[model samples]
Target: MNVTSGQEWVRGQFPRLDWLPDETLFSLCSRQHLVMGNLDPATTSTAVLGLSEKFIKHDIPCGIAALEQNGFHYWGSAESILLHHTIFSVFVPFQNKIKIEDAIITIKGDRIDSLKYRLGLVSSGFGAEHPLKACPYCMREDVDAHGIAYWHLTHQYPGVLICPRHQAWLMVSTKSRRWSGRFEWSLPTKDCLIQQASSQKLWLRPAFLNLANNVIDLAVIGRVMSLESCTVAATYRKAVLQGGRSASLLDRIEPLRRFHLFESLPEDEKSTESFMNQLIRTPRRSI
Candidate 1:
């Protein structure tokens, strides 16, 4: 941050720093914002809200000052950073969960934006209020080695209830990305995790952790996988039938519903079995 006479290079004030492993755009933005001033995270968020308006391009950095300067490297590539690390990145993967689509690779910018109407993700309804989580042991290790701590993208995924490394339970801070249009710049604290870590033995409960890991794996694959097919549901039905549970998936819907994450839905949507059956009957509606 050099000065020419009394003039300062605004860009150099907050130059893009080397990114951390598995960092997300919001996390990176928050980190950069901290260098600017001691203002509230809400103000920082408002300042960077324009970052979301950007679309990927071959050149011109990421359209955001700090990110564009880095040439969009590290943690994730330029393409994956924009398409998967940002908040908007959730749309494509979530929609793909309905059905795999090869077209996801070539999805038009406008088409992606239009999903705003079909899916109400912007209002913090879909996995937004879900707390920004951190692993306590990881934080301690990072702070001990690097003298700082920050959020990891892996722990932020909704279904990732446990830390893959250390096999410790991840914990959320007091703040969350609420629908109030204000984001909080909360770094991991000592109390960020539960006092007792029940997930420390995840390896022993192979079945439970394996299922969660599978979902996380799909989350990673969904990023690069084409959006042209749907196999998860069919495979689930096959497994049920093979186990002599029931030929019709409906027969086991009650058991499946117990594990499904429907807490984010409205009370009316609490009926997972009914919704699953509806999607089955009118499969085209899913598209």
Candidate 2:
């Protein structure tokens, strides 16, 4: 965690540091490392955020304020960085205002562990286990256009198996959290693509494709609107209760078969069934 000194070369408006559209802050620092010929990830981290690369995060990055202050103002303010470059926008519609504000403050102040608990992600049953993913087509195109492959924020999430623009499957990175050097700078490249992951073959399933589309849609909508949970729940309940059938019948309908989806279902897959039942049973509340 050595702090780099005498970095006057990166002091102001570094035109060489090209911040690509939808590029993760981690990718920006990684690109800067290549552009500046930094000897190691730690040196790049020190130059970009004045912090340690040990704390470098991809999904929801911390030290945003530091990045903004460290001659990267052209990328915009911390708030803009959170909205545009990080995965913060995807959680906007699902989380409350106070939690959102706390996340922003924590991200700016370098509380990486606390940010998860603050956002209710500790019990959300998502995130941590998912690998960083990238669409191969996007990577190839990025290399052709920008001369380097970078990570995209959209493809790096739980349940986001498909690429929105290309409608192609996303490949999980082998050098993800499961790897020993997870915190080290990594970009989307063929050498790091994990082809043996279970979900690698899930692109053939219609249900998964549907889920991916919905996830992408929510991500896009969440950027501009804060959807109410009650409203969303009520709408889902209404759809389930359509045709004058009790919501209990939802369990009897084989979702995979009905939609001609997944090859196998987990024996203990009660979460969705229970959620829909509860949603239908609960009285609608004013939003």
Candidate 3:
């Protein structure tokens, strides 16, 4: 359809479409300039129409910089089946705001891609209202990394769940803003869980150990059991063990007071030690 016809349809769907043209529409339409409403008595109509003009000049550099500052990234664009029809699309967060004059110049051959106004519904309360599921490591909710929400328990994993290729320990903190933390693991296997837990006490710094204790409390109170229950503890232990003298010094200076959380320390200690022992005895580093 023509620009005016399309704008009329859009206005019918959204009453607010009457406002000044926005970047979102520009990206979607891929038209340089759009004429809204008719100026002449012969073409007068209450409905707004978008008309495509030959030269819709815009400043490029300023526009693109503005968009980048607000966390929008260039996705891609496509040409319509009809001749001279193109559509550009970008991924921008709904919560962030943008203005019209923001322009950035980019040269591709002779064509220029200009930044316009921002679009998208407000996502302020979107993920906030929902309960976050604990990741396997830091026992916190998974969050978007570089735009997409990650699913793995720890940030140590490159993208999604723990890397299937590496034996890296990933951790995420509920109290911290960092997406992921990484630690080394010699031979990551099922039995290593207990070993890592036991060794954690010997290696982790007091501050991180305290952090681990807090996570344990949260897990118990929340009553949401999963690999996080074991993995969180394992991560803390692995961090301490691999952290070497720096971690050991912290542990020595700040000994943890006994908490009545677990009923039997001896039994717990033995079980964890035995598990670790088996892991150390095994000879395999298969990812």
Candidate 4:
């Protein structure tokens, strides 16, 4: 493939790639130099000299020499050139992870001839924020305080009430002393509250008398649980008593939606909903 053909295919897959500036491509290619170690330091340094010879052989030295001096490397093999050009083509922002099988290159006499390589969408992990720890639910290293608190589902003892926390969820395990679950309080919903409490810093306040009271409650309760779920249920009960919206069967849809990926379906059409919907709507206790 040529540069034109590669660009056309990339633009077709992702419309956003069409607007990237030339400097972005250069930056991507520079970063990928470490990945493709085929060209050693000696070969890299001699690239300009090689290009100069080619220019002289073609009887075009004046402009070609200036271009060669401006960091252009001449590859004797088409494969090497195609490898470099492929890196350049896929350097679009927010797109990474090009598959090697998708690339196109020409070869002649055990050397790479002129070729164009198609670039794929870049990997999403390229510019993502790194977390200090892993999330228990997703088991991903991308967990943050805000992400854990706001995005995760909270389950109660009776399995009737489910909610997402606007603040941190305290996981109390029957066999554990210290809390062994993740916490996120930096999400948009609790950001203002956390800011006001700690002057914009991550803070934890030790409960003195309340800690004793919570221990007493847990001892009498006989079940390990999430504090946030209890709080949400209590709040919901009060709202319902005051003429709020009654919890409907539709509220179960979210959990059902979550399990959809496990549903058994035709091989070609297997998806999240097919498996989960069946499980959620059926009563396992009766079975």
Q: State TM-scores per candidate.
A: 0.62, 0.81, 0.17, 0.13
Q: Could you give candidate 3's per-residue lDDT for residues 149-231 as a string of tens digits? A: 22221112111112222322333223122232221111112222322232334433444334444443433332222222234
Best by TM-score: 2
Pick the winner on lDDT between candidates 2 and 4: 2
- How many residue pairs clash in model 1? 8
The reply for model 4, stretches above 4 Å from the true place, is: 1-118, 122-287
Query: Considering summed lDDT, which 10 consecutive residues are worst modelled in model 4?
Result: 53-62
Tens digit per residue, CA lDDT, model 2, 102-213:
8888888765776776676656555545567888899989999988889987786556677877877778777766565636677788987865345445334455566677
Give the number of the best model, judged by lDDT: 2
Q: Whole-model Cα lDDT per candidate?
A: 0.49, 0.69, 0.26, 0.25
Runs off by more than 4 Å, candidate 3: 1-71, 74-209, 212-270
Expressed as tens digits, the lDDT of each residue in 1-287 for candidate 4 is 99978755643442121111111111222222322342443232233223212221100011222222323323223333322222222222211223222222111122222212222222221211111111133212113521222211111111111112222322322211123232211211222211111221222222212322343344233222222433444665564456423233223222322222212222222332343334334233322
Per-residue lDDT for 1-287 in model 1, tens only?
34653233543455555567776565666576677574665444434432332332111113333333333334444465555554334344446543223323223222233333444454544443356678888888878876678777777665565678877666766545344343455567766444223433422344334544765676665566533324545654555457643234343332223332423332333354464543334236345
Clashing pairs in 1: 100-227, 100-228, 100-229, 101-226, 101-227, 101-228, 102-227, 102-228
Instruction: Report the C-alpha displacement of residue 30, candidate 4, in angstroms.
Output: 7.6
Please report, as a residue range, the 10-residue window in candidate 2 with the lowest summed lDDT. 258-267
Which residue runs does candidate 1 get wrong by more than 4 Å?
A: 1-8, 46-78, 83-117, 120-128, 177-182, 191-208, 226-233, 246-282
TM-score ranking, best first: 2, 1, 3, 4
